[model samples]
Target: MGSDNSTLSSDVITLNHGVQQYFIPSCEKNRKIKIIATPNPSKGLVNINFENWDDIELSLSVFDALGKLILNTKLNTRNTQLNLSDLSSGIYIISIDNHCGGASSFKLILNSN
Candidate 1:
């Protein structure tokens, strides 16, 4: 709801019954980053691409639609590929948790065909 930077990057959501949710973008307000996966509806070969944050390790978490933790690892590089051929077809969430109290999430679809 409030942003400490010049741009409006932070978001606050209020739901019924006074429920509040806060969303923060990547680490620093000025630093731009992206997480890309090739062959989106892939049958296992997944390549995640992002800008390398020198010296800063990124924590990655992959969860299924049922909120089950699928993969957890630390990425020290900017580009990486994952072989998820063993996973079943479904919707999954990939979260990048930064050390600067910043977080980014994305949805991934895995199709084994």
Candidate 2:
């Protein structure tokens, strides 16, 4: 049996057998936006907080389990409240995107009792 030697670079991998694999690394390492949501399993109302978001234009969107758009709006403050009481109990996705190329998402659970 022969030995296998491989090398890896910042964005590529090379095998001793003359094979190369290339890939692009994610650029989100320097993302300046952070978010947190409270009362995950909420009945209808939820509060969200933002961090490191100084004068950054960000947009918030909420989508249901079926990939339907539940809410979409621009965030104008570091803290905001969302009224989901009208929505049914289920798992939803909250996504925030910074027009400057940063984006993040969170999973929210709604419970009806």
Q: Which digits, one per residue and each the tens of the lDDT, describe model 2 over residues 1-106?
A: 9786655554222223433222211234544454657777788888877666665557889999999999999987988999999999999988877665666676
- Model 1 over residues 1-113: C-alpha lDDT tens digits? 87443323333322222222223355667665555556566778778767435446788898989999989999888788888889999888878777887787766788887
Lowest-scoring 10 consecutive residues by lDDT in candidate 1? 13-22
How far residue 94's Cα lies from its native spot in candidate 1, in Å, is: 0.9
- lDDT score, candidate 2, position 69: 96
lDDT of each: 0.68, 0.70
What lDDT is reached at residue 35 by model 2?
A: 60
Candidate 2: Cα lDDT at 85:
92
Q: Mark the regions of model 1 whose C-alpha exceeds 4 Å error after superposition.
A: 1-26
How does each model score on TM-score? 0.71, 0.70
Q: How far is 8's C-alpha from truth in model 1 (Å)?
A: 20
Clashes (backbone N, CA, C under 3 Å), per candidate, total 1, 0
**Model 2 global lDDT (CA atoms, 0 to 1):** 0.70
RMSD in Å for candidate 2, one decimal? 12.4
